[model samples]
Target chain A: MHILVVEDEPKVAQAIKNGLLSEGYRVTTVHTGEEGFFQAASQKVDLILLDLMLPGKSGIEILNALRELGKDTPVLILTAKDTIEDRVLGLDSGADDYLVKPFAFPELLARIRALTRRGRSDQVLKLKLADLELDCITRKVKRNGYDIPLTSKEYELLEYLMRHQGHAVSREMLAHDVWQVKDRATPLDNVIDVHINRLRSKIDTNFDQPLLHTIRGIGFIMKTEDEP
Target chain B: MKLVLSFRTQLMLLNTLLVILIYAVAAFFIYAFMKNRIESVELEKLQEQVSTVSTVVYKSGGDYNDWYHLGDQKPFLIMEDWKVSYQTTAWKDLNFPDKLTPGDFNNKSLKTYSAEQHNYLVKINFVRTGIDTMHNFQVVVAMENTEALESVEKLARSLVLGIPLILILAVAGSFFLSNHAMGPVKLLRIKAQQISAQSLSLRLPVINARDDIGQLTIVFNDLLTRLEYTFEQLKRFTADASHEFRTPLTSIRSTGQVALKNAGNVNDFKDAVASMLEDTDRLANLIHDLLQLTRHDAGRLKIDFSKEDLVSHINSVIEELKILAEEKGITISFLHPDTIRLHINPAYFKQAIRNILHNAIKYTPGSGLIEIQLRQEESGIIRIDIKDNGPGIPPDLREKVFERFFRIDNARSASVGGSGLGLAIAKQGIEINNGNIKFVDSNRGATCRMVFPANSAQDDSSAI
Candidate 1:
């Protein structure tokens, strides 16, 4: 996946760039609204991470200008201004998603994945890792060709983890992305742990190779046992 | 403290005093004129009585005893050659002055005399019956004036009594008039008193827009509107500032927590610490900028200004920001007269120039040209234009750029290391030195122009 990050802060841009690069995605970053606009207009990318505050032109203006030019690329707004009005304006101005600044990298990556997946309807909507398979259309999970019954939240958690396989996902990431909880300080770590344990017992206990692994203190990661 | 009367009370008292003065003057004139008329009419009647008495005595051929036929009740005394020749029956018991003589009587004379607690009008007539015979007789007739005097006294009494009554009525009338006139003002006072910070939208009732009180209320409502607008702006500014402050702090906290929880090696720890340090630095910068803004708003910040070459100052700022420009591969060029002198605080001037230049360098793409041009106009105003070959600001947002905490591009500005106070601070700094700064019309790029008077008399020591 190719992603364009239109951000002005050098440190933040670098951090996001590093995070996205480590996620195995090709990333292009621009520091100004005008440059961001030019790149978005002329370049082909799967998704664009737009910052509202920029030099040369504002993020909304760029979004509007791009939409006016008939560019249907998915856009995710990342900004420090998290007011309700700001969010409404960003969404109303053709942004596909809105994320406030100081966001978790995992949550950002999750949102990016979601936005990127929205445009590719022709591709198969299934997730697979070794013997584990999940069909998005049927909302079913299978391991070694055997059906695995899962709750909606467990399925969502599994899907998110599988989408970001081989990477450490924090409890905050799970709470924010899967549960859609905006406030990260809430005590949901035990709930997430309970659910993850339940999912591991149901999916990995009866299997030869474990696909879900705990990163101890950090979060959880889903991968084949032989992989890292 | 001096005593201050309320507007309503003052109006009432003034109106009452004016009414009393007018009524008193009118009463005085009426009383005087009535008294004069009464006295003249009484004297005229007394003179007619004396003339009748004199004709009767003269026709009687100076027969003293015949004067009794004129009127028995009327007091008359005829004195001839200093001797009482005839006296009425009523004058018999009356004591007459022994010095009564014809010399005391002119052709006809009328005078008032009080006798036995009764007012009398005395008329005396002197008659000489033969010119050669020299017979002179003084006939005196006295008539009681008690009725006319009683009527005049009654009128005087009524006047004395009516004046206070009229004044009392006048007082009541004036009070009512003043109260009615000030009714709208009273309503305005009550309504204005109810307006607090929370109820800024409430307006004083304007009953009559053409009246003075109504006009005053309209003006007050306009002032309230302005105040409310300012309050809203202040609230928004505070909210935005708090949000801006919270974002970086949240980043630092979250980054630290995640780093501590997830770090499994030295490299991970180093990377986490580096990110946390970056967020912390951003937080520190935000706080510093907020503090500076607060100080400036409170007028607590002092500026030290001296006469210096403005061209060199701009060059120094440009040189300082050269590394930042070089990082983006943007070229900055300066064009100015040889030595353009201006009176300014070097620090504040440099800060202002640095902000504009930084914005230019940050916005312009790599290999884009940034130009700084300084020229002295014929009007003795020094102008500096900072133009950038970047996406210029929209026309509608040109003026809003100076607003506190206002960012055109929220997302890009966040990453650009701007707290949204750079232009606001720069505008304030330039204004403090008696200069003007604004975004001028440019065809292709953003042009920010700062104009300063060649000889600014405003010094840094003075409060702005």
Candidate 2:
């Protein structure tokens, strides 16, 4: 999937661009409203991360212009203005979603994932890796064709990881997306570790190969050993 | 030093003065009229008596005895051949002139004389008895005029007593009337005094809408309403400003705390520092914009105006902002006449234009088209219009968008990162240059128009 980031602040734009790139998505970053508008109108991207205030053009103007031109690219408004009127106006201006500034990066990624998932034609109800299988509709998991009981939080964390399978998932991402915690200041890494340890003991203890791999100092990755 | 009196006191004094003047004039005229009437009546009575006495003597054929027995007791003497031939007993007691002079014998010759310390009216006349005898008699008649004098004195006494009484009544009545008239004004003053900054909602009482005082109260109430509204708006503005500042500070604190708590690695510390730096930059920008607004409000934002080619100046600003526009893949096109010179504060003028252009670029989509046009019209106005293919501001918000801290999309504006002072500052800058800026009607995109008087450029230069 390809995403375009339209932000005027160099650091913010770079951070979002880097975050999306590390998630195995093609990302393009632009600093001005005009450039954002140009790339959005001319290029094909799965999603557009739009900033409201830009040097040349505003994010809302770009969203409106693109919509006026009949472009249906999903737009997520990222702005510092968090008033109710601002949110309503942004969504009413044809934005698919709105996120306030100082938002958790994991939350942004989750919203992006949700928006991109809706645009795809193929819908998968079941996820499988090695002997571990999760039936999304039934809320059930099976390991080596045997029922593997899992807690709700563990199941949710597993589901998010499987959605971005074979990619590195940061502890902050897991805490924000899986735990639904917005405050980044909360010390949730230990909790996330405890949950991950429990889930690992349940599925990988009796299996020959472990599917979950930790990328030291960065985050965690879920992939089979032979894939590398 | 001039004496300053309250309106009520002045009004009362004026009413008293007018009443006294009218009374004094009326008394003087009445006294003069009464004196004239009383004097004339007394003289006529004395003359009638003298004529009656002379007729009785002439009819008796020079016999004075019959005249004395006529029963008119008024003092009279008829002398013939230098003798007091006919005199009443009362006439002998009066010190009358024994030899009547010819001047005294003239008809209707009246004089004021005193008898027994009483005022009397006397008249002397000459009478001829019979044509055959050719006898001339000098008759003098005197009647008491004390009654007429007493009547005049009575009138004078009444006037002297009544004038002060009437003046006192008029003064008291005027004081009451003035107090009644100014009662509403006093009420208004009391109500106005009760209204403080905290109690601005209070309003003066309007007792009678048609009266002057009532109308003044109504006007004062209207002013209070406006003041209350302004005060409320100021309060809201202060709250919003503090909130704006607090949000970033909170974010910086949160980010730093989290980073420090999880600082097991150098990269974690680096990430925390970076986020803190971004927050600080945002804070600094906000403070800068606030300072500019404060200076503008204080009338300390100085603008040194001089004659300059506006076209070149605008061109340079466009050049400076083009790179920013190019970053978004936006195109900016400028069209103007060969040269348009106007008196303007170059820095401020450029800042205003830059703000507008920046807004257009910020709002327009990438690869959007921005068109700027400048022209000098026959009306001596230099008009500049900047049009962009962006979502135009809503019609309702066109005027409000210029207000301080006004953002159309608060949430969107936050993430986009702006101090919300760009347009407000732009407006101030333009006004300082004696120019006006407004949103023009456009079919597709937002168009902003600015106008400056070209003639003033020459006027300013000549004055310098």
Candidate 3:
């Protein structure tokens, strides 16, 4: 997998580069916003590590510029200013994820792996729970080969839950992963509830057995929805 | 002099002196002028009596002997030259006084004089044998003891007594004016005494014109204004810091809920749990610094001093910074034999030294040198020189580097993950323990120094 790190601080950038290189991923590092913009457009990078505060330009501006050019490559913002305003602005500017600095190198590695999971976007994978089967590609959903229609948000949420199958994900994780957004500005669990409700509606409404089960006091789970 | 006593007594003594001086000067000059006028009038009356005798002697065609007595109700004038001369008709004799009167000028030499009944003033005139002027005669003027001269004495008495009374009133007036002049200063004292951190908004009243007191108010009020402004800025900064801190803290906490709910691996859960712990630590540090600053504001920070070996303590501090140094491939060295031990609070003193060392290692270039020197000087002071080859602090802002919440450029980056309270805490700790810390000397980069007394009984074994 190819990743580009756009950070201004030498130590943090070098650390991330060396760390990612050790993980056997192709990593290129750039220190300027203009350089990040040019590299994102011309280079074949699967992911980008962008610092929010930069010398020449801000990471939000770069993120927005990349998005405006229809580059959907996941961009993770690395920042030290852990303020709601910065997080909101970063996500709203089309960043895939946000991570505050002074972070453990292990967390950075986890986020990089999570971000590069899209390299397998085209691989065929079917998620089956009870009678519900979702085609990973072709956007097909069926109940015993009977077709079902799902909205864009429902499909994305179902995809995220099925990717972490057999386990419950809280409202926050669901919000960040499925919504690709920060927590504060969006009414966090409320959006998660609406999308989960709609996904359950398309997948479980009028079906004989429900596959999306709500885990009380925690979040939701995509399982057989059976007691056993 | 005692403060309050001096303030009141100096004015009181000055006013008494002034009033007494004015009374003495005015009474003395008035009495002298009145007495001189009275004496001049009395002398003129004596001269008139002498002239009367000369006129009578000339009218008598140079009589050899005669008696002349001028009779009034009380005879005040008599002229004689071995005889008496007067125009004593039967009507004059019948109308004259039979008893002596005070201040009446009389002489008995004009006839069979009765000295027992006469109260007189006498004057003798001399005549030379060769001179052909009018015959010399003796004259006396005894004015009756009448109220006319007594009125002069009464006038002098009134002035002597009345002058002091008026002076007392004038002194009282001076005291009143002085008190009135101090009115604004009293208000200022009250205003100042009422000021606390809670009520820092109150300002000194500037109700008067620009005298020294008014100028004092201007300066004092300016101090108050600055204090209020700093308080307000501090309040806002704390709010901003808290608000900023809560976001990341919330993120970490919420992320924990997810990690716990999912059947995630121990490694993944540990990552999430570690982030939460880090956030809590940062939050705790922020609150701790804020509390420390509050204590400083209250002036309540105290230090307990004891034996501290600078050499051993510094080695441990350097060892503490070694973890950070190892990350960057930088090294710290002590260039001098550290033979210094002083009395200090070991915990806080060590904290100050560790902060300086940590900052040196934090800011220095990779493969750079941090040199520490400890030397004892003749002035009874132990000085520590901690120098680093790094990007030096800009000349303009060296002092500001120690202020709370003060950070230079790129201070908030991951490369320098300081809480921005290290130097502030170090300086505060240094001051609490009765030591002085500052940027002592810098060469191509920077050198900072902290010095304190070296004459204490704390042993120096760790230096070797």
Candidate 4:
């Protein structure tokens, strides 16, 4: 997928470009709002990652100008301001999604994947990684043809991790998506760690290979091979 | 010209003007009355002289020499048979212009005349010295009233002269009275000037609490007290925030420096980076919490209240944190009714209850028991108690723990991985929801008691 990034900060813009390039996506970057608008109007990018505070023309003004020309390309807004009104205004101005500043890289990747997969009807009910399998319908888990008993919270945690098996998921993503915690300051870090340890012990304690892994300093990841 | 007068000066000027107005009115009435009294008395004296002169002439048998002694002291004119028969020597110089006849006495027996700028009171009388009509004679008595009018002029001069003295006395009296009345206010001003921001604890002396100025001083002192308290809290908050910020930065710096000097392989370097990353995450959370608190203090956060099932909401919070407690072999028991609806901001209420529950799980040891009780009192207050069989907080530090960055065991808090702002944020959220949270004495462990008033805990399902 081709993504257009409009950001004035050089370091942030470069980091985004490198991250997205390594993830096997085409990236186009611009510094000023005027150049961003020009490139967006001329190019055929699949998605646009626009920053709210640009030098020449504001992100809101450009979004208005683009929408007025009837371009419906998906746009995700990145902003330093995280107030409720700013989020509402961004969405009202035809933004497809919004990410607050200082957001985690894994959280950003998750939002991008969700935004790009907006209209797809692909749903996976059963998830597998080598010997472990999860049945979303029955809310059951099994490994090596034996039933694995898990608590309700553990089931939810395992299903979320298995859905995005290969990618590392940050604690912030789990806190928001799985735990449904809205406040970023809630002291749920230790709780997430304990639950992860229990889930690891329960599934991998009696197995020859462990499917769940911790990427230390980052978050938890599920994979077939043992690697950091 | 606009003269900006002080309050005392204005009072003095008003008093002086009032006194002058009263004195002027009295002086005018008295001057008029004295003039009228003197003039009427002079006319009566002239009438008495006329009767005496007529009697003397009646006894003398119409002879001028016999009554001439009475005329010697004043002026007199005698007319017999309608002709001027006798005139006093003094009466001749008086310049009497008109001759007196019985016709002049027809309507009045007295006349007043002014000649040569001298005033006179004249009385005319007709006397019968014999039985025949020819023996009848008319006597005219005239007196100069210059001295009577002179007495009246003297009285007016004296009255007019007294005005300047009264004015001087009124100004001085009013000035002294205003100064005495404003003495307390002047003292208040001098004392108030001595108070400054550095010395906010100083109070304005109340000279008389029953008076207006004293009451104003008391009110100002009350305001200063509140300001001083808020100022002190701000100073402490700044110091604590700086310390919190430095704690994580210190760890990160030390870890980085050690890694650079001692790392022999990429794994060692990676381990150091990981540890530093953890510290940075902690710092980020601290900054986020501080921002949330500042927003709450500024009254910038919007609250949307709705009716929710309190039992289910709290049950869910406990459920969410049950795994953490279970991981430590701790057990939590929640005792509540099947349903208890309340008006509250769910997000804020959840944040508060979640933080309190998290603190309990963190402090409670392995195999410890945490009990949550929810019930409504008879006084229409909804109370929730979260008790844990852990080391309890001392009574002295119960209220202090709500302060920002306050910890019961400072050294042990670091290992607990708490940002030290949990209870502060919890207090703010609970206050916004019209609830109060405090620690109550329990026989075992710590008990956090939260209460909501009747109005806040009301069940109004139809209204949002």
Report fnat, model 3.
0.00
Clashes of each: 16, 24, 19, 0
**Candidate 4: stretches off by over 4 Å:** A226-228, B1-197, B458-464
Fraction of true interface contacts that also occur in model 4: 0.56
lDDT of 3 by residue, B215-326 (tens): 8898888999999999987896676566647766787879888898885897787778657755654664565555565666696544456766778888866754564565
lDDT tens per residue, model 1, B1-464: 99899776788778878877887788788878888998889878778878888787677666656666787777877878767887777766455555675456543476667767787777777777643355678878777879888887887788788778877887788779888988887787788899998988788887888888778888988999999999988989989988988887898788789988886798787777767755654564566566566666887555766877988989977755675676578898999999877778776777788788877887898899999999998877889999999999998999889888888888787666667878887887788778999998998789999999755733434433
Off by more than 4 A, model 1:
A1-228, B1-10, B47-75, B88-111, B115-117, B123-130, B133-139, B301-304, B453-464
The per-residue C-alpha lDDT of model 4 at residue B23 equals 91
Minimum summed lDDT over a 10-residue window in model 2 chain B is located at: B455-464
lDDT at position B150, candidate 3: 64
- Cα lDDT tens digits, model 2, B1-464, are 99999999999999999998999999999999999998888777776787788788778777656775667456777777646677776676677766666656454476777766688777776777764677777777778888889999999999989988998999999999999988877877778788999999887777888887778778888999999998987897798789889988998999888987877688777777767766664675576567666766787444567888989989977865675577678999999999988887776788788788888888889999999999988888889999999999898988878887889998888655577878887897788888889888899789999988766755756331
Q: lDDT per residue, candidate 4, B244-283, as tens digits?
A: 9999899999999999999679998989988987887888
For model 1 chain A, the run of ten residues with the poorest summed lDDT? A181-190
Tell me each candidate's TM-score.
Answer: 0.60, 0.59, 0.46, 0.82
Assess the local accuracy of residue B290 in candidate 4 as a C-alpha lDDT between 0 and 100.
88
DockQ metric for all predictions: 0.01, 0.01, 0.01, 0.59
Q: Where is the poorest 10-residue window by lDDT in model 4 chain A? A: A182-191
Global lDDT for candidate 2?
Answer: 0.80
